[model samples]
Target: MGMIVPSLAHWLEASELLNGKGMFMTGTDTNVGKTWVGKQLIHTLRVLGREVIPRKPVESGWNADIQQTDAWQLANAAGLELDNSICPYRFSAAISPPRAAHLVGKHLTLQTLAATCPTRWDKRQFLYVEGAGGFYSPIADDGLNADLAQILGLPVVLVAENKLGCINHVLLAAEAIQQRRVPFAGVILNNRQSLPESMDNLNDLRAYLTVPVVTFPAT
Candidate 1:
């Protein structure tokens, strides 16, 4: 089968639905293609002539030698320079951000993480903040990604791997986001593999979720 990229119309609808300062992107779990979906959205926003402010804030599996770190990828997509403001906390260990910070005898707080994001917003600027790991995953010494999402006050966008059990994962994450009272933009089901079950994940998610559910092709 051919690769299935999201149409321009799909992204345009996304821009309209998420018509706010920006969005807080979280995933059902780690490695669910959060960065991939984020890059695509950022690219689309740029094409629409909106200034995109991409922030990863905290990344655990950071390797300075590698140029394709999540922060770098987000930066490259937004056509911005890789700087501390974009990803303030970086650890070489491939673990949770809090655990990675612990390994290096450093501690991160929710306030510090939230402060890294740009405060100023204009009609021409759109903020795209990507959370580390899943929504409940520990991003700082003090809080989970959900907590940061609440603090940022941006509409949450859930990205999940389009595979077996994805419906359960997306629903659970959505519940958590709703519990926090964060505005939910929608869901992006990333088809990274050609799993037979992956073909139906989008429809399954839409049936259970009232928000927009879109598919993203594998890279």
Candidate 2:
């Protein structure tokens, strides 16, 4: 589908709904620029004059500061001063949330994560919930990101970063979303796959996924 505006700019416009609603940003897989996309969403909202707080329900592994995860990126991009508890669960291991949390001797619950989010229309400028890993990524022993989104009752914006395997991953994620009865806003394709073989499959993906594919090519 054709884009209405740059992804970030479009998210800036979507921030208007956050006064009474929230937005869930999930991805097709890990390392798919999910952090980048979530940050842009918050940054756009802040630029649009909204006080937006970005969050990652569950994070795993840290390069240096354990607290400086995806949530930090969003806060930095949005220029918002958010306390560490704004993103409650910080797990180490750099793996899927549940596994990473287990490795770090921390167990996270979706209900707690959902409940801990900064709620209330007046309390927060806007809430941007970024999922750990992908829609089907495990947040708890059995809970997935879709479960988190369902509890939040927010429209999902899926981020697909792979070029070749994206269509399959996207369709799988859509199925998960449907199973959880969550509303999907659309899918954004992080256009970083440039291998000739991978590039050859881009058009194929554009034709297959049942949702709009918003591509963010490498600059």
Give the Cα error of residue 88 in candidate 1, in Å: 1.4
The residue pairs that clash in candidate 2, if any, are 61-92
lDDT of 2 at 180: 85
- lDDT string for model 2 (1-219, tens) is 122336556533443343436678888878899887676556556655667767766677755763366767776766756566666677657787778877857777778888767667654477778888878878877688878888889878888875666778888887788778877666767766466642544456557655455556433
**Which residue pairs in candidate 1 collide?**
none
For candidate 1, the lDDT comes to: 0.85
Instruction: Choose the strongest candidate by TM-score.
Output: 1
Worst 10 residues of 1 by lDDT: 1-10
Give me the displacement of residue 179 in model 2, in angstroms.
2.6
Error of 2 at 9 (Å): 2.7
lDDT of 1 at 152: 94
**Over 4 Å off, model 2:** 1-7, 10-20, 65-68, 195-211
lDDT (CA) per prediction: 0.85, 0.69
Q: Each candidate: how many clashes?
A: 0, 1
